[model samples]
Target: MAETSETSAAAGDAGAEGTEDTGIDPAIFSQLLPFDPFDPAFHADPYAVYRKIREQGPVTRTPLGLVVVPGHAGVSAVLRDNRFGWGDGATVAEHFSEAPDGTTVRPFIFMDPPDHTRIRGLVGQAFSARRVDALRARAGELVTELIDKAVAAADGGPVDLIDAVAHPLPAILLGELIGVPPEKHERFRALSTDIAHGLDPSLFLTPEEVTRRDSARAELYEYFGRLAEERRAAPAGDLISELVTAEDTDGGLTGHELVVTLTLLLSAGFALTVNLIGNGMYALLQHPGQLAWLREHPEDVPAAVEEMLRYDPPGQMISRVALADAEVEGVPVAAGEQVMLMIGAASRDPEVYEDPDALVLSRPAGRNLGFGLGVHFCVGAPIARLAAQVAVAKLAALDLELETATPPRAPYIITRGLRELPVRLTAAD
Candidate 1:
């Protein structure tokens, strides 16, 4: 989370690279009902808007034909059903498929079965359970060090918890996970931040912001390409080296695919995980009952993290295109129509969770759409979970107070997060 002028000015919306959209008219969604990225009020509390959307029905359509699914069951059905995807790039939003340079390569997240299965499988090979699990101890150590620095830096005043722990913790670990040298950690964080703001549809951003995003993407592409080449020549014990050699029935990835995949993993993983920690902490501080409960039941950190995700998710919307005629919760969807799944709305659907809006750490562990579902479930979920749990548990051990009850949230519609969470921290005696 190296902040740029545009990113900071915009209140720091975190965008996932590759998911950035160039075409498909963000203007349509901006003006339409049930979703408005430009509205400051909506950004502050989108769940309130979501409640209105859910009241409409399982599915609602704009005059422009964008299908909006706000109910939990409908959103889940669309995600798991094979009939919905970015088929043949026709239904895929240009931002998700096309680059600023006019090239088109749908990231695996947007691809259909064969291609999606192939690339994701190769990626999964590199992202082994053993590799991810091994990072747990290291993550805890990093959180401890970061919290210590935040406590020391406060000097009896409010500190930006995001800068102290949420932002850097994930960036450092992601660098370690991807084999980035310690020297380049700051650069890595900065580029990812620029790309994160650019992750919103082009319509929501200013011209300058879009330019910075594209520029950052190009720079990252060059960097990853060089790194991949280096790894190919002499493989290291890092995930980048592992990815260089990852193969399946289709054989190894091309140099370009390797670069794209690496960039995707780095950018997407970094943004979501950063927001999870930031948003989760903000939620806890808002609910003192839950915060006290977490302190009393330290073992429940993981469960509390899940509840945080559901209560105020990092990734709020997931887009899908119908490949063929299909139905979501009995709503007919023609081929080529785009369906926007409001994850924030579905997670809070009263039909699914008891007191869906409450921050209930003790709530039963159940299926959630926080990281998504089916083939596209977040690949970095295990690591993200580990990072958030460690950060939350450590932060909760302190006497914490929010400097501002209602923090400024990023205005980006797709992802939901606070710009900064200033908290007064003191060690528990």
Candidate 2:
């Protein structure tokens, strides 16, 4: 609390700004109870702040004049209610200085209805149950191949799972899903990294980030557009082929839209899957009983994956704008106001689950907004879930232990993940 007081003095108390003060300092408050999606502190440990908001009330009006909804019901209500939407450019332009055209290039996930509905239906078609199920075989193969490499690299030393297992497994799988040839997988990572970094609502970007974003978008357009054209002509078996050749009758996506959609799939799938693998593995190792149970019953991999998502989700924050004067669970919301849903916090809401903070592998099935809900739900969710289930199941099958050295986490505010998790693989007796 003393530390919080010092932070309040340094950053100015919220009380002075007419907002009811959280005992935590505004600087600390910004991190924990972040009104700003890019708040540096909240990126550090948002779970603490999520708890604070849930405890205070379902709806929190931040010092930034932003509405933060933390409870599962409130967050779910906001996402499902058509009253809230992705809002116009003016809503986001206040923070990001990207060009207006650049904003149009925002991923389909950031698009509201009509456009969201159209693109999602088209993109969603590519990830049919059969397609995703077939992709699972490839995911399993990649997991095995990556695990072998991790063992070889370990050669009696600790292995960084991010390098050998977590990252490569997903990268290769995503490349295959998008029809990228195996040889180009190495370069794919750098491109995906650059594109994924801009997936946030930020006040500003460093000159470097701006450069990377522009470069990534251009490269994606050129690269995927080439692949898309080839697929349209050749009609190969992969997702890109399906997308290019998909006939919607209501006029299919334009060439530029196809390129942009492919770009979103490439970057979003890899980034989220990587985080899911890293975060889930870390969570399981942190809770040995749960880890042991998963190892003993591999058939439970699906439920375990679900629990992992709820325990430590990759997508932390999702927001929407009130399309018009509206109310969330009866709380009056003026037209055009922005409401941020804390995904990670909502999962831990006591009202939603028993022992909300604990990791329980056998926890009863529930709707987790980790992949989000409603119209904007993750289109690649099936593929992501399958990939993670295989990765975690395989990893748990080994009698390994997390390395004593603290692993480095993906320090970015956008995705919560570990960059390099070193673990010691042990032979089963």
Candidate 3:
């Protein structure tokens, strides 16, 4: 998740208010003294702050008690290295305590080394290309079904694509893939979205929002825990079944691990895929030439989808705590210190791509950290990519038109996507 804190100087909400910027690098302070995420200005256009941060060299120490790495080279380097990690079980348990139920639930991704290896291997099988591919036929069916509804709703009148399709497609697809029945989809979507916001609560949310996150965490565990019971009662060959019933080298997963893994599968990937489709469509519409090119060359939709991931990923930031003292790209980081890797900024860094900001559909996009890197790389990446590839190609094939100069942007710091992306079908136009 993208880190949010120390609203810009414009908002005057700096580094938890009363705290001084005694440790912030002078260079970053001069350019972004108060990088205000709380300010309306930042959410509307966070890239501006990121650009400024990126310009201040590879890594800038922040007064927020973490170093911000915005440059492409540094961000990518940190992600690929193992010295930095997010699987500190102690930290995770501390976080869970704030929730009403206060239970420690460690997802496989949060496990390091041998633990990660065991869980990933089992979970990996469920997401292997072959396993994920089996779902594509259904995914395509859902896309077509959603597009049909979108077309009918638009009737040449503008409609929010997210409302009509983007959000539902993945919400439904993930529900089915994870063994969630159609009846549970609405509740699943709501719980997943709220729990995802818990990733970096203090970094970007208001007090009430943080409270909502805490509540969501407890509810999410309960919701998924029930599903685990169902999967155990009757095996259905679902991902949940695989997780609940399968055994790893280190015996079968603990019960806590099972519930937490389900939670991760349900919440972690749900919201982001919504954004992926939203961000992809927005990018296509913003660049008409590219949009037109995509419509004509639908065969190359996968490449276009890749470009979208590189251009403006849904999940924008990754945080890691140093396991031991380590230097990233020559910048010193002490043990236990946190580093925020700006996924969005690095994707746009000029050092990484020639004309990085421009969305060239055919560019060799290389390995974008949109899905993260190394151990914690997103497990659902293949599924998310396939969703964009197929759904985007379908939308392009439909020739939907952008209905406004700017769609409503999702007003959050760490996440970027539209609140509502208004579009109209060609028949409506």
Candidate 4:
């Protein structure tokens, strides 16, 4: 979830829109603004800034009139509401494009009703919970294999868990699930990283990075287009085959739609699961007592995973445009307005969670905006959760210690993940 060009550009146009739209003085707008997205300190600890935003009341306005919803209730409301979406593509047009063949190439997650409803409905049939749950046993097996290989390669030295497990686990599973050949998993992972970084708001990307991101997306589209054709000629048991068959249904996904959808599923799913595993492991290491509790109560690992998502979600911000004049938890929003739903901030809102800042492994599972809610909810959530649950559960059994108290954070803010989580591991004496 990168900011659409309109919202990102709004930051530049804020001076003019500030007084004209919201009657807020441009000079004092900086004081009213949320944490600086570019600051490394903010990346390390955005919760502090989230707390400050919460103090400003549930909904705050950015200088350019983009609405900021930091409260859990308000954020959830907008997500579940019908009136807010990527309407007319004015807000997120950067992410959506016209394919060279002149077909619309927007991810369904960014589309408004009717279009979104149709594609998601078809996608859901293939991405069912039953289908996803079938992978748990295999996921566990893969995690065990990955961890053993990591520890053996470490040879008692520090290993970067992210490099060893978090990144590879999802890439491998998604490859298997999406019909990508095992030989190409590494290539998929590399492309996923480029696209994931590109997914950050352009404000945060260097020109070189932007070029890489665009190039990666183009390559992936071409790769999937070829794969879709193969699956069409001879359908397989993977998700791609199921999606290909879906094209036969009336008003079903076109060839271009299939490619973009798979791209979204693979890239977004990879980034989300990787961060969930990386962030969950880091949180558990930071809170050893909770880690120990989870080890003793292994059945509670599912609940613990939920807590991890709430504590530090992978997708930090979700962008939406008000399709029509709407009210979010009583605040009136004009039509065509852009809203920034701070998932990180909403998840930790004190009004929703007790000791919002603390990580409690046993904290009862409740709704968190991590995977979002309503129709636009993550279609690949079940698979992502399964991958992370297996990865985290497998790693928790080991004798692990963080090599550094503060590991470096990923440069991109959208996917709040570590570049690498270096750690020491050994067999229990």
Candidate 5:
């Protein structure tokens, strides 16, 4: 998504207070500071604030002149609109360079059409529907293996589901997909988490986090680079190898495009999937009726997966910059303005779905911006859906009682999901 001048200015003002003379509402400014994108508290529970913004209007201008699109229709409109441009590396550098260390991180997913088109097209072939469906058997096998280990570890005792299943399953899957060695999984997993956290702007990091992020980036680039080189020499079955040889009308991705594309796929590929599984499990356990229903009719697994995504999406929101001056949901937004599309809030908008707050597995499948919309829709969506279907099916089949220690939510806002989900299982006699 593109970042607008309004958003950059608002974010630049960070913790400052606004006055009537400044043409900014004090309440709006207060909400903006406390709800910084990186704040853990915001991640824990943002629905209330989302509600507030939604009721205020579909589009509301902030003290910093940035517009916030909160309602279901409003958020959906932004996602579906083509006029908004995805910002480039320079934009990211401008927004994040204010940090103490002043290092810039660029992932190709953040670029505009032609560039995004070229990069995404190269990697897109690997995540084709057929390829993802073909992996279902493997995905199910992996889930079963992880579940077996979890059941054994439980031994009539409690198990931290996140550590045993939630984290490792997707990590292993992504690793295998990218051809990372089994032995290097643990190291790479740790690095991925740290780097993901570093991307959060609200998490005030010490110099240590800065150093770790830089190091992680270097290591990841080097690792993927070597793998890409090997793929060039002799292609393999993995995604990297496929990208190394992929071609589009324009041409194949360059070395830099390949690196950036791989980086984004690696970061997004596992983190959100793990969260989807973990969060979906937690939700089902909390609502046992839904759990039992899913278990009783395995045929409903696909619908259940969609409901899970709509109910508590792994990605809370996405940003876009206005390519031209446009009025969104009646609010006038100038060109180069930044708009935040609240996907989570939009899914829960009562107008879009009946009982937006309630989780209904059988609800008619309406459009969901959860995977995004328009040309920038998530490329990994098919694979993610297949993986989730396999995961939820296996989970529903198990004879288990979910014991929630605490409501699960990540400490970061952009990618939201369960940190840890603890549960108990009763072995089949």
Candidate 6:
């Protein structure tokens, strides 16, 4: 990787032979600088803003020293490139905090290889494709049960889909897999929401937000720590118990690692999947033609799920730090510089797919940075796909008549989804 001069004279000229300038308009970057992505206004309709950034080109450098990769190729490259490090705490300090404790919250998903490899290796077996498939039938049964309940309660009136279906489907499935008691699901949901909401720096005071997050983390750690202990004493059929007893001949996970893995799975699992269901459903309702097509051909559900991920991903952006001087799409980045990959924009880039904005299930499956790429790709992706597939399939099967209780957008930049989607349902003839 090489550094290049940032000047108009050098901008148009190709700096490196193999690398091409992303040719992003500098003005677009200036526009988004003042607008916080987590603002309610932005979330209400981020696609308009995303369109402006994507049209400008693939990459732009923000005033905040963060490079925003908007198009498919540029975003994909950053995600796949190993020169970028995911777990650099120094970048967190630069962007969000300066506290020592902030540096100590080591999420395994943030680590580079060897460290990442070791941790992922320990937990990968549990999320393997076969294991995920084995659970799909049971997952579908849960989805059917929930939808039946929703229909029963509708009574020709609007039903809050988030509460009745979208939220609970994944929550219940994940709870069962992790061995969380049914009664504790509500607590887990609240805690996860608190932790996610606290991620936006503009929303809360640094100290207050940090404290809230740390407290939530502590509660999770304590709860899972106890669960791990119980599992160790008397193993069960659930994931936590299996993890407790797992060994590699050399040795098993330490208490700390076990707890962190549980924390990662529990926190990352349901929230994103819930958003996937919510976002996917909202997209379908907006495009009634697609909704009808799905109803006519339920077999297309899997492709519909993929389209949802590409059109409006559950995650909007992911961050990484440069491990060394790197030239990405002609932008000069030094070691420790933070890069923000705009997944929402990238998924809609015309370069990667035709008519990127329109929801076309017939479109051939294309590469997407939705689950990310490289070593740090989402570990729970299999379970997420299964959960979303089941939820969407069941929902499409219903004769749905949707109504917005309160406009369907959540105020968050990191995760893209609806806060609520109320709908009136009737059984299909």
* Predicted model with the maximum lDDT: 4
Per-residue lDDT of model 3, residues 13-73, tens digit only: 2234312323333244334432655456676667777889888878887665667888778
Model 2 spans > 4 angstroms off: 1-45, 92-106, 201-203, 427-429
User: Taking the candidates one at a time, how many backbone clashes does each contain?
Assistant: 4, 2, 9, 0, 4, 1
Q: Estimate each model's TM-score.
A: 0.90, 0.87, 0.86, 0.91, 0.86, 0.85
* Model 5 Cα lDDT, one tens digit per residue, 296-399: 78898988988988888887767788888887877778887777777878878877889887777777898877788877788778777877888888877777
Q: For model 3, give the 10-residue run with minimal summed lDDT.
A: 6-15
Instruction: Write the residue-wise lDDT of candidate 1 on 1-429 in tens digits.
Output: 111121222222323221243233434444454555556677777889899989999999877567889998998998899998767654334344333366765567667788889999999999998998899899989988988887787888888988889899989988999999999999999988887766654544566768888888789888888898899899998999999989887798877777777777776778788899999999899989889999999999989999989998888778777889999999899987777888889999999889887889999987889999989889999889989998998899999999998876666656677778999988897
lDDT tens per residue, model 4, 1-429 = 445664343232232432344443444534434655445577779899989988988888886687889899998899889998887785666677467687768888788888888899889888878778888999999888887888899887898999999999998888888889989998988998887666644543456657888888889889999999999899988999999887425666888898899888876678788999999999999999999999899898888999999999988888788888988878899998878888999999988899999999999878878998988888888888899888888889989999999997764545678888999987553
- lDDT tens readout by residue for model 2, 1-429: 000111112222123231223233335445443443334455456677679878878787766567778889998998899988766645443222232255445456667788778888888788788987887777878787888877886788988877777787777878887899988888887788776664432223344655776787788788887888888889879999988867676877877778878877876678788889888998888788988888788899999999999998987767677888988767899997777777889989888899988999999999888988888788888888988998988788887788954576654444578778888886554
lDDT of each: 0.79, 0.73, 0.71, 0.81, 0.69, 0.69
How do these models rank on TM-score, best leading? 4, 1, 2, 5, 3, 6
In model 3, the clashing pairs are 4-203, 7-35, 7-36, 7-37, 8-34, 8-35, 8-36, 9-34, 156-428
RMSD of 3: 4.8
Candidate 4, after superposition: displacement of residue 362 in Å? Answer: 0.7
Q: Worst 10-residue stretch by lDDT in candidate 1?
A: 1-10
Can you list the residue pairs that collide in candidate 6? 87-110
Clashing pairs in 5: 2-320, 2-321, 4-337, 4-338
Model 4 deviation from the true structure expressed as Cα RMSD, one decimal place: 4.9
lDDT score, candidate 6: 0.69
The window of 10 residues in a row where model 5 has the poorest summed lDDT is 12-21
Candidate 4 or 5, higher lDDT? 4
Residue 254 miss distance in model 2 (angstroms):
0.2
Position 356, candidate 5: lDDT: 80
Candidate 5 achieves a global lDDT of 0.69
